[model samples]
Target: MTLDEFEDTPGDEAAPIDMLEDYFGARGWSCDRGGDDEIVAHVQGSWGKYELRGVWREEDRVLQFLAMPDIRVPDDKRATLYEAIGLVNEQLWLGHFELWANSGILLFRHAALLSGNDGPTLELDQAETLVEAAIDECERFYPVFQFVLWGGKSPREAIDAALIETQGEA
Candidate 1:
């Protein structure tokens, strides 16, 4: 659904996921329901595909989105990956990168505190920006991750190389 339709929804009568699914679908974005309280999508960016997972937390009155690349850090590179993620997160605005130790997964996560009397945030525009920014930042840092994981570049080198600004309208 459009943002207007979402805003018109009765806060207490329907779950956010219903509106979320429509919000994404109406934009020609793929949305997949992951169980009762989650929606998953692959957001394509210049760097690669980011798996964007939106999860609803009933107890906290919050909605969270995690955007992650398709690749995983190898067991041997986990330590370096952690350092790289720390460097990458230092410059981020909306979310931070994390390495899931048990699963060797890397993700950029952002959370939205629910508004109104019930359900998730009514600020769909902010939600869009959060998700888009997460994916964009993921793209910006992916090269550093690759350098650490397979190119044998030191954390500083990888981060510095990635940080080199290209002149253009951002």
Candidate 2:
């Protein structure tokens, strides 16, 4: 679900963040406070070390969800950074949808970043299809972040649109 679609209930302004924390904890995940209003959860799954960070800003009424591996890439291996980034991006997308569907919840404003220390790089951004038109924009530059604004009727549609955009770039 997108930030705007995450309804604010009565008498509970921070309910969203609390719900996320609870969800992760109930699954045997360890949660820690990252920044002032950010919660980071760590879970060791069969795939690898999963680190999910949720940043909530009450003042701005914004929330950001970030997922990546717990390990940091060494400076020397930066040459093959694309491989690492691809792994992270693929996992995040597959994991996010799986979790959301399992929990019967929607995720909006979904974006991803795939960076590489070497030359080749790719970025993917997508959102729910009903919420907005599909956007599959890419650049040859590194350090690119893909933005997917959620709140669509169907996540599949959004993903399809994004894929089309990605294909066009390629």
Candidate 3:
């Protein structure tokens, strides 16, 4: 389903998971509706591929989204990766990065509180924004992690190098 098709969907009729699944599918992204409340998708970012998972908690009226990059932080690099994650997180306005120590996986997680005065509702546009933000942040900071883990650069140096913005096109 494309955005146009999603737009045609009656907002009140679709659950949060359904909306998210449709949104990802519209972009020709590979995604699976794991269940009534869960959806998983793989999104290709400029840096690499990301696994995006969405879970809708009806009781809590919250929607949680996680974006995991296809990279693992080795044990030797975990300490530096921790420092790098701290530095990178300080510069973000939404969500945060976390390392699953057991699995050595790095992921960005953010949740939306859907419990409003009226009721819990997740608009399609809001879902899109959430997913977009997650991907954008992940892409923006991917190289920083790479610099720290593989390039043997200090946390500060990694942040500084990854953040350099070049003006105009080459």
Candidate 4:
């Protein structure tokens, strides 16, 4: 979606929520109200399924997007996953990629802090950029997780194999 399509306020709602509502809806993904001002977005990627949650913090005035692959990262691979994620997170600009030790869930999390001058206004590109980064990170590193989980490859080996130069028609 373009910047013009994201007006500051879409009706009575803030732009962050509206931008996500329209963005995910346009892709035909089920955008359900996930209670507590959060919209849960579910979509299937090339490697596996994913869940993107957009939570609008009314008090903090921030929109946080949490993206996680459907696959439950095994505990045995957590250390290796952390190693691989360290390399991956270093290259990221927007948010940090993390695996929650408590839940064994790998997540791409980002937050856009909005200004409360007139109202919480979120630019379309700003919201889109966050979501895009989340998805991009998930898609790019999915294979590494699979390698560690199913292929039984070491973290270094998996990252090395996944990061190899892949040339093909886009």
Q: Quantify all predictions' global Cα lDDT against the true fold.
A: 0.77, 0.37, 0.89, 0.80
State candidate 3's TM-score.
Answer: 0.92
lDDT of 1 by residue, 1-170 (tens): 65566556564223556556766775668989987789988767787787878888878877887888987878988888888888787887787989888899898898877766553443556666767788788888888988888888999999888789789796
List candidate 2 segments past 4 Å from native: 1-14, 34-36, 83-170
Give a tens-digit lDDT track for model 4, residues 1-170.
Answer: 43344344365244677768877765667788766577888888888889999999989988999998887777877888888789778767888888888899888898988885787876656767888889998998888878877898887898889889968978
- Candidate 4 lDDT (Cα, 0 to 1): 0.80
Residue-pair clash count for candidate 2: 7
Residue 36's lDDT in candidate 2: 56
- Evaluate residue 117 in candidate 1 and report its C-alpha lDDT on the 0 to 100 scale: 59
Q: Compare the candidates by TM-score and give the number of the best one.
A: 3
Clash list (residue pairs), candidate 1: 1-22, 1-23
TM-score of 2: 0.39
C-alpha RMSD by candidate, in order: 3.5, 16.4, 1.9, 3.4
User: How would you encode candidate 3's per-residue C-alpha lDDT over 41-142 as one tens digit per residue?
Assistant: 998889999999999998998899999999898898899999999999999999999999999999999998886656666787788888999999999999
Question: What shift in Å separates residue 40 of candidate 3 from its native position after superposition?
Answer: 0.4
Estimate the lDDT of model 3. Answer: 0.89
Model 4 segments beyond 4 Å from truth? 1-13, 167-170
What TM-score do all the candidates reach, one by one? 0.84, 0.39, 0.92, 0.84
